[model samples]
Target: MPAINQQSEPVIEIRELVTYYGERKILDGINLTVESGEIMVVMGGSGSGKSTLLRHLLSLNRPAAGNIRLFGQEVNKLSSRALHQMRQRIGVSFQGGALFNSLNVEENVAFPLREHTRLDDNTIRIMARMKLEVVNLAGFEKLMPSQLSGGMIKRAALARAIVMDPKLLFFDEPSAGLDPVVSADLDELILRLRDAMGVTIVVVTHELESAFRIADRITVLDKGKILITGTTQEVKESDNPRVQNLLNRRTEDIPVNADEYLQRLTDDLAGL
Candidate 1:
């Protein structure tokens, strides 16, 4: 869909994106747009290409054919230095925290500032602490990753991501492995970050509850195609069967083709 709101330039835009792993196609002709200050939740089952799309959005992976624009700048055409400069404005909280074990929570949170800026140690420390407070990890800053619970680790990672006060934040699986209460708290935190900081947020998650709770709009991918992109209610009331199956958690029964299976087995046995 052309951005739901085009009154202003989109924060992120993808057009006719096509990607492949070796010869196997992954993302197929995807086109998406994320508006400023809106939370866009990308959801899909396994092998649905949600992660591939995220990689493209982050400029981690390039598409075989298409354009990716961030803040109205073409990502593929940017020079390395320009790309690095653009990346500094974006922050990512990866799945599993991805924190450095050698560092405590505060040090981990300060790493981005330490890398990107010439701020003094005291200023970096204060900035990191403020972000920790925002994520409700204030007193726990002294703790190491090994010493914190799953939720604490997530919050610490979040503090690190926002330490730079980025204009765009990418959160991968924010609710994964978190208990219901902790997950709900994290959802509220995401909402608060957008409202208070005016940052555009893109969350890649399979957690339906978290997606619906935090998303202004959602993009649902199914086998590399978008089933629908709309508000929570529009997705709920979607007439598409694929969308309905995903929403209702209905598993499809695949009827195997014996001829295709035999051919695949024959190819593997022949090492083709």
Candidate 2:
């Protein structure tokens, strides 16, 4: 990734963000900033609210409190039309590729341009092929998603994600199910995307190696709170026990109060 201009405003900003599911808090008072042309990796274990944060950032789920600003506009304050327009400037490559099974690689990549732009079919096909080439999937455009390998599926999906040339790109678990070599290739592609396109990137994953490999800065989340946000070296040298435990993959034995545990069990039974 390239060095960002520190004088400019962040492309993505979250301020004291809070979210919940029923009575259980999912994200609590979170704050972070993603600068232009940077790759920010958000990593945590399951139930640590990393995915929830991504959902909120994508504007799929509204926060219970606080605010999210993308491109200098508060997301929650935008009207439906305005929000849709805002989304046009953003792109997301979902976990599982999220490519339509019915669509071939070319059609899958062209879907966004066809839906979002007024480009003619010939132009859309050309643009889709261009993005496919960027991801190194040029000659396989006619193949169905089912025909592609796991890495190819990911690359094809990435091509679709960048087809519109979004200002901000969100990647969900880009290395979740790949072999080591494939995972590293994906990581390199991510770095290239940020460096070549100068697009701000946010990657949500539990893959520690991938996070460390691609992040310009990393934000580690635990139980809905930010543990630390820093450069890879700073995170590696963190003295905070919780952060260290996460990095070392050490399980912490958290003592539970009997009363609180009983109350939680009683509450669950009552709800059931």
lDDT of each: 0.91, 0.93
Candidate 1's C-alpha runs over 4 A off are 1-6, 270-272
Candidate 2 Cα outliers beyond 4 Å, as residue runs = 259-272
TM-scores of the candidates in the order shown: 0.95, 0.95
Best by lDDT: 2
As a whole number from 0 to 100, the lDDT of residue 249 in candidate 1 is 91
Clashes of 2: 0
Tens-digit lDDT string for candidate 1 (1-272)? 22334588999999999999999899899989989889999999989999888888899997899999999999999999999999999999988999999999999999999999999999999999999999988898888899999999999999998988899999999999999999999999999998888889999999999999999899999888888999888998999988888888999767899999899778857744
RMSD to the true structure for each prediction, in A, is 2.5, 1.9
Model 2 over residues 1-272: C-alpha lDDT tens digits?
36688888999999999999999999999999988888899989999999999999999999999999999899999999999998888989999999999999999999988998898989999999999999999899899999999999999999998998999999999999999999999999988888888899999999999999999999999999999999999899999998888899999889989999988878857646
Find the 10 residues in a row with the least total lDDT in model 2.
Answer: 263-272
Superposition error at 121 for model 1 (Å): 1.2
